[model samples]
Each structure stands twice: as C-alpha cells, then as structure tokens.
Target chain A: MVIALCVTVALAIMPLVGVPKSWILYIFLFFIYLAMANMWNLLAGYSGLVSLCQPAFLGLAGYAMTIGTWLDIPWWAGMIGGSLIAGLFALLISSAVFRLSGVYFAIGTLVVPEALRMIFFLWRPVGGAMHGAGAGYMIKGIGDLSPHVVYWLSIFVGVGSLFLVKGILRSKLGLGLSAIRDNERAASSSGIDVFRLKLYVFIISAIITGFAGTIYYLYQGYIEPTATFNVRWTMTLLLATVIGGIRTVEGPVVGTVVVVFLYFLLARYAGYSLLIQGIILVGIMLISPQGIVGILRRSKFYDSIVKRMK
Target chain B: MIYGGDIITPILMGIMLGGLYALIALGLSLVFGVMRLINLAHGDFVVMGSYIGYALMRNFGIDPILGLIISIPVMFVLGFFIQKYLMGRAFAIASEIPLIIAFGISLIIQNAHQIIWTPLSRALNTPYSHMSFHIGERQFPVSYLLDFVAGILIMLFLRWFLKRTYLGMAITAASQDKRVAQLMGINTGRVYGYAFAIAMVSAAIAGVFLGMTFPFTPTSGISFLTIAFGTVVIGGLGSMLGTFIGGIILGVVQTIGGYLFGPASQMLLVYIIVLVILAIRPQGLFGK
Candidate 1:
C-alpha cells in the first residue's frame, strides 16, 4: 500500500515540473507494458493459460481504437470500445481453442494472430494496401491533453489493471482459477465452472491487454500491423513476466521496470540487444526458473536486509 | 478465369510442398515423441541449417546439393550438444520452462543469423532453380520433384531404420516408454541424443530444400515454425506417418485456398483449417 501510494503521488506530481517529453513517454510506455505483463501473468501464471494470442488481442484493440476514432467516437469511449472488440473476440474464440488442452491450446491460439494478420493484410478496410491500420485515424480531442496527461492516463490504467488482477486473486473466482490451474479434473469434479471461469479470466485479461494497446497507440499517434501485432511485443512482455516472477503479484511490475531500463540501454544496438536479451532469458531460466522474485526470496542478501529491518 | 488445369498446379505444387513440409515437421515429431518436449527453436535450427548451406555455397563456391553433406553432420553435432547440455537442464523444471528456453534459443539464433548475414536475402540461384518439365500442359518443377523424392526417401529410410536398426528400435522403445526401456538396460540419454541428431539431419536437409525452393532470410524461421507445428498438429502429434499426411493435407488446404480465395489467403487458410480441425478433434485426426 505504501508503495502504491508513493507511486501514485510521484506520478501525480512528476508532470508539474515540466519533465522532459521522453521521460514521460518512458513512464507511459512502462505502465502499458506493466499492465500487459500482469494480465499475461494472470492468465498463464495463475490460470495455466499460456497464450501467445495476447498480441492478437492487443493488436485487435489498437485497430478497433483506430476504427472508433475514424468514426469520430470520443477518445475515452474509443479506448473502451476497442477493448470490447478484443474481449468479444476472445469470448467467441476461446471455447473452440480451449478444447485443446495445455501446449496444443497454446499453439492453437498462437495461430489465430497469424490467420488474423493475413486477414489484416488481405482486407483493405483499415490499412489498405499497406496492410496496416493507416495513420489517418486519430482520436478526437486528444490534442487538448498534454503529454503528461496522457502519461497519467497510462498510470491510471496500468495501476488499475494490477489492482484488478490482485482483486481477482483475492476473490473466490481467483481461488477457482488457481484450482483450475492446479488440476482441471479435480476442479471440475469439485463443481467449479472451469470453462466459464476460464472464459471470464480470458475476456477480462484480453480487455486489459486491449486497453494497453489503445493507450499505447493513442500516445504514439500511429499504428501499423507489423509494429502493433509484432511477436516481439509478446516476447518482450513474456520475458518481463518470466524474469520478474511468473506467479508473483509484484513480479510483472518489477519485470516491466527491468525491461524498460534494459530497453533504454540496449535497443540502439539492434540485433545485439536481441541476442543479449535472449541470452538473459536462457540464463535466467537456467539459473532461476522461478525468476527474479524467486532469486531474491532465496538470496541471503534479502534475508540479511529483512533481519536488519526486523 | 479458373482453369481446370490450374487446379492441378496448386495440387501438384502443394503436394510437393507438403512433402517438404513433412520433412520440416518430422524433426519436431521425433523430439516430441521421445521427450514430449516441444522444441520451439526447431524452426530456427532449420533456418540455421539453411544459413550454413548459404555460407558453404556462397563462400566455398560449392554446389547446393553437396552443401547438405557439410550442413547435416554439423547440425547433428549442434543438436546433440544442445540437447545434452542446454536443454538437459530444463528437463527437471516445469514443462513450460523448456518452451520458453527454446524461444530464447530461437531469438539468439535468429539474431545471430541477422548479425552475420546482415539480412541480405539469399537463394540458391543455380541453373535448375527454374528448370521444370512440361507434362500434358502442366509443368512440374524439377527442383520440387527432387525435393519431393528426397522427402519420400527420408521418410522411407526412417521407417526402415526404426524397424531394422538396433539404435532405431532403441529410440522407438525409448519414445514409447523411457522408464521401461531404461529398466531393459537401454541408455535413454544417448538415445535421446541420437534422436535429436536425426531430427537435426532432417532439419538440415529441409533447410537446403527450403533455400532452393524460396528466397530466405534470417527471420524466415517463424513462418517455417508455424508450418511445422501446423503440419505436426494436423497430422496428429507423435504419429510419424501422420506427419506426412498432415503435410499433404496442409499443402492441399493452402493450394486450394489460393486457387479459390486468392494467393494471399494461402497461409491464412492453413491456420483456419488447423483451427477448425482442432476445434472438432483436439487430439488431432490420428493422435491418441
């Protein structure tokens, strides 16, 4: 709670001093990524639904926002509207894809984006010949909000999502989710609505992911299929969530910060960054499969700090 | 504008492509059969194999066909070391951990290729690249015919080896029940290495065929990976015969979709068919 309060206060006040545009953009990007990582963790970590389809939902929301803005919808409403599109898509598709359990289910969902991207590439509605949602689509009245306002909007959405995931985990539904993840057959016999509950988590997770997509593109003021729907985005979030802590509540946030920090340092090197990040992922898995949180929890350094605190 | 003969073109071409696709998926099928571990880097290895071929042919001024001789053994050793050393550690961890590890391995390989090759697309530009024979108004590409023959030969060889060879039988036994096979005094670890090495052989061969068939770059792994999984899943995971069947099925789906729904829908249709198949039969057509 204190951490939350500090973050809220700091972000709330950071914009007043006329902070540089890039720093605001960095924090803004951080929030979106943090939210996404958390949502991915909720599905994969808690519910045992490891989906590469997160990018599909994210890209779907982005395009929906573009379409909404193209139709002159309010920016706020457009974000929500875009999220709804992603949620609905998930709702309709999950039943079919979820039939395949475990790794097959993961691969099944992975193909959806490739198929959809082809549709995006072939269909001329949004991106036209360029095979991406065009730059002409812009949110109405977005100009009135300063960059910091946009940044704070990201903060609100990001923190809200983490709380939402935390809220779910605290509730009975969360118990049901954990139950499903632990053992589906037992969960089913115990009278938990495993399919329905999974659907709910999936839709909710997609919505939050969709929201990130909307805010991300809205702030950037451009969208493209290659950029928006790229697998790199999924890899980034997956790496973050895995590195920070797969199942821990604070892991995704910690991971998002780590990734953003690394991005600032290594992104300029292009292919080298990818190679190093890949090495880091393998190294992390080899060294600590449970991730940074797991490492910290096990380390003597953390124990010493805790002993001193006590 | 839909000529009847044109239908045969996609069919013949897709069947040949399916032959090659079967080759691609078989490596994955072998690993999954023995270990139940999905090598997400399976496609990257194939691409890496292709890059090795590219380097050999470009730098040493060697023929594309002979390039496979060098690439195959090299890949075999690489796969052996990766399985014994890197992937060996993840086997003790959760099932998902290996998949993520493989993804990381894929990223490393792909970027490494990008760094070395500088993303300048390369293809085998031999005289036979476009050479084909016309048969009753339908032309068949000679290169594709050779690829199809190579695929069939490899499949036949795998079947023979499994039934006839001691090591192959050990691999089959190990795949069926590693613990039981272990009790029978079979060294499952070395068998896994052999199986992985064999899979690499297929991937290395497929890589050459792929370069000869199409223009390739460092990032071409994912597309091949998708097709490999698609074929494996469609053929029913763990079924060796099903890999070939699945490849043909996928090829037919792509070719027919292109002939009917425009060329862009070829890949889109492959995914759609797999999705529909999974929805209807999650265990796949022949998978138990």
Candidate 2:
C-alpha cells in the first residue's frame, strides 16, 4: 500500500528532517501506539481474547530492562530478553487463563497485572523508596540512552510489528485463530487445537506489546509499577482497534494515527481533554460500531463511485 | 498482636464493611441478571450518590443515614432514564457497544466530578462521622452498625419484592429468559428500567456509607468498581443473598490481609481470594 511506502520513507528520512527533537519524540510515541494496537488487534480482534492485561507485559519488560541492565546485560539485549520473558510468562499463565471463558477470562487476565503491580510496588529491593521498581537502578546501566536511539528503535519495532502480524495472519495460525473466534466449539470439534492456537497468539501478542514497553522505558529511562501497569494502556488500544475497525489489517494503523494526533492536540489544547475524549469515544461507539475505518469504507469518497462506473 | 480486641475489632468491622459492599454489588448483580449488561459506571454512580449525600449533609444539615434515604429515590429516577435512553440504545446496537459506552460514561463522570467538585478529597466531616459505641469494651463505629442494618434491610426488601410482588417476578422472569418473558407479554423494557433503578438505590446506599466511612474523590470509583465486581463474582452471580455474604467474606479477608501484611497488601489479598474462589468454584458457591 502507498501508506506503507510513505511510512517507510518517513522512517528513513525522519532523522534527517530539520525538526525539533520533541516532534520526533512525539512521532516515535505514535509509532509505539501503532504497534501496541496491532498486537491487541491480533489477540482481541482476531482471537477474541479481550484481555485487559497488556500493561502487565509492558511493566514486566520495563522492570526486566532495568534489572537486566543492572546485572550487566546490554540495553538492547536486555529489552529483547524482557520481551522473551514476558512471552514465556504469558505461555505459562495461558494454561490457567485459558480455562476461563468469555468475560471471566478478561477479568482473570486483569487480575494478573494488578497483582504484579502490587508485587512490583512492594518489591523494595529493586525500587528502594520508589512506588515501583524505580529509575535509580536504571541509571547504573545504560548511561545516557540517547533520545535518537530510542526514536529509531521505536520506528524499527513499529515496522517489525507490521511484518510480524502480517506473517501470522497469513499463516495456519491466523486461519485457526479466525475459526476459534467465530465459534470455539465448532473449531474444537474440527480438531483445530483451539487452546494451543489461542495460547500461541496470546504469547506472541504479549511479546510484541512487551517490547513496546521496553522501548518506552529505554527512552524515558524510568519505570513505575503503577504507571506501567495502568489499565488505561489496554483501554487506549481497545479504543484504537475499535475506531480503526476490528479484524482489518490497515484499521489499527489508521486508528492509531488519528488517535495519537487527536490525543496530542486535545491534551495540549483542550481544557477538558478527558471529557472530550470520553464524549468522542462514546459517540464513535454509539454512532458506528464499525469504527473510523468502517465509516470511511461506507463513505462515497473512499468507496470510489467512479471505480464502479469503470 | 495477641490482644482479643485487635483481631475481633477488624473481623467485626469487616463484617460491617461487607454490608456496604453487598449493597453496592447488589445493583450490579440485578442488572447483570436482568439484562446481562455490566455498567462499569455503577461505581461512579455510587460515588455520585456519595457526593450528593455529602452535599445534603454539608448544605442541609442532614444525617448521612437520612441523606441516603433521600439520595435513593433521586438516584433511582436518574438510573431509570439512563437505562431507558443511553444504555438501552447502546444495547440495541450491539453487546460490546454497551461496555465501551459505559467506559466512556465513566470517563465523563469522573472528569465532570473533577471539574465540578475539584478532586480535593472530600468526606462527610460531621460530628457523628467519627462517633462510635462500645461493644464489650471494644470500640465500634455507630455508622458502621447503621450501614450494616441498612444493607440487611435492603436485601430483605429485595427478597420480599422479588418473591412476593408481580413486578418482582416479572423482572426475575425477564432475567432468566427475556425472550420467554416477552412471549408471556411482560414488558421487558419496563422491567429493565426498574432493575436499573433498583440497582441505583443499592449504589446510593453504598455511597452514603462510603461518605461516612472514608474520604473519596472523582477517581475513587474504579477501586470501588473493582471491589463490587469482586464481591459479585465471589458471592456467586444471580444470588442477592450470596452477594451479601460474598461482600462480608471479602471484607473479612481484606481486613485480615491488612492485619497480617500491612495495608498495601490488602488489595492483593482480596484479588487472590477472588481468583481462588473462581478457580475452585466457577459457578460460585451459591450460584445454582
């Protein structure tokens, strides 16, 4: 798609552009959200997991980054290791978590992040006096994790997520996940190994989301259990996916771009950012469950009335 | 640590606190039973009630108990309209839409409260707020006793209303099978409207107790939402009396958790209890 080419070109030339470093940072954050939404879409939109625990992986990756760096691991390696650990932990928990069906599964997943936050909050050995595993441990390891490194790494991860998700969607896993989503009992009867497929998607999604947090903390050079594990992260991605259009490839991308920019502008300019965001969210869901992409598809402009004539 | 008062006090207090939690969770169970919708804003509505009740106390010199009584009818009406208009419309569109709408509603309510009340922690700072009576030489807050009694009365009233009244049976029948109830010519919409209104009354009662017992802010709803949900799940879904007992059990566990591992660990312990209960009995202890 032309959109992908434009994004690739933008990523390539972004560093050379004579813009303020803060603008670059903002765009980098946008890319991070893009990836986060993709990851969530894979699980929720495709597999119907509907987990509210993405932050658990994010926090884990972040805490792992700090701890790994403290233990003499390189910053980049630590971040990767953190993602792998989050993936493994997700795999381990999926057995118990999978036993739950529907909303209970969602609530079960949520409890994981909350419990982890509490542990990280009270795990004084890492954080010292801080509420979560503090930033003090971070300072000892990656000295001045330059802003440029973070920005580029974020873009790289963002692109990586696109390919990663695309590959999965093209595989047997994707077909199986689609089947599971439509009807669990039917899929199970068809011998799709529904549980295993679901677990795989869950873990893969967790890994990607874990890396989103890693790059985030690596950039900020700080991590807190409460902030890192906030349910808002999950909610934001859910909103983005819904707005973009669930079960569509380009939906998250469009949704993320619109959301991140709107969020930036509103928080900066609007006096009542949350109130406005809430109003918009409710309006969007109520007026159109298909989301922005769905709306766009229905529009005469995007539908290309001229193409039909041709 | 060994003192008789130390353990006895928390257990009794927890039992009292459970009554309030039960009142809060009662509405959630009712709504879920009847319409199968979870109003994430249930906690916010409860907090809103607290704010209203607090205003009644501050401005009109009303007792929180009496304030609760007045708050209930107003809340019922408000809840009725919201269900009839906002949530009812959302449910008509899609199942998932209501949840998302509820989330947005919660966001709006929280921010609106912030804008209006200015989130500096507020509570019912009245003379009787801290007033207590002695129970076998152990101090017990009078408000806690009142809340306990109120919770029990609400539960009793709900039982009488559901089992004895035609409207109650209609609502129950709708909850069990809306399509069947509709086939029988019961007005399911009106039943849901009443269910939500009754749920609001429950939330208002909890709000009154929360105002009396603890400081709360605009952001206070989420924690209470979590607690109320936990109580519902622990107590078993669709059973009002079970929800009451679940609330009490949660309170005891929370207080005991605080007692053994300091205050910060209380929530962790409560979450553990919820998970364990779910794992052991997914149908809930009294679900069937």
Interface RMSD (Cα, Å) for model 2: 1.5
**Evaluated on chain B only, what are the TM-scores of all the candidate structures, in order?**
0.95, 0.94
Candidate 2, residues A1-310: lDDT per residue as tens digits? 5656675777757768777766787688888888899999898889988888899888888788878776677888888999998998898778777888777787678788888888887775543334233323343466766677788888888888888888999999998988888888999999999888988988898899999889988877767777787877877787778777777776788778767777777665442677777787788877777777777877788767324522
Going through the candidates in the order shown, the clash numbers are 1, 0
lDDT of 2 at B189: 88
What tens digits encode model 1's per-residue C-alpha lDDT throughout A1-310? Answer: 6656676778777878888766776788889999999999998999988888988998889878777666677777878988999999999898788887888888898898887777766554543223234323344456775776678878988889888988999999999998888889999999999989988989999999998888888887756665666677888889889988899887898788888877777767778877887888888898888788778888899767545533
**Candidate 1: residue pairs that collide:** A127-A132
Per-model TM values vs. the true structure: 0.94, 0.94
Stretches of model 2 off by over 4 angstroms after superposition: A127-139, A268-271, A303-310, B1-5
Candidate 1 deviant stretches above 4 angstroms: A126-141, A300-310, B1-5
Docking class of 2: medium
Q: Residue A247, candidate 1: how far off, in angstroms?
A: 1.1
**What is the total number of backbone clashes in candidate 2?**
0
Candidate with maximal DockQ: 1
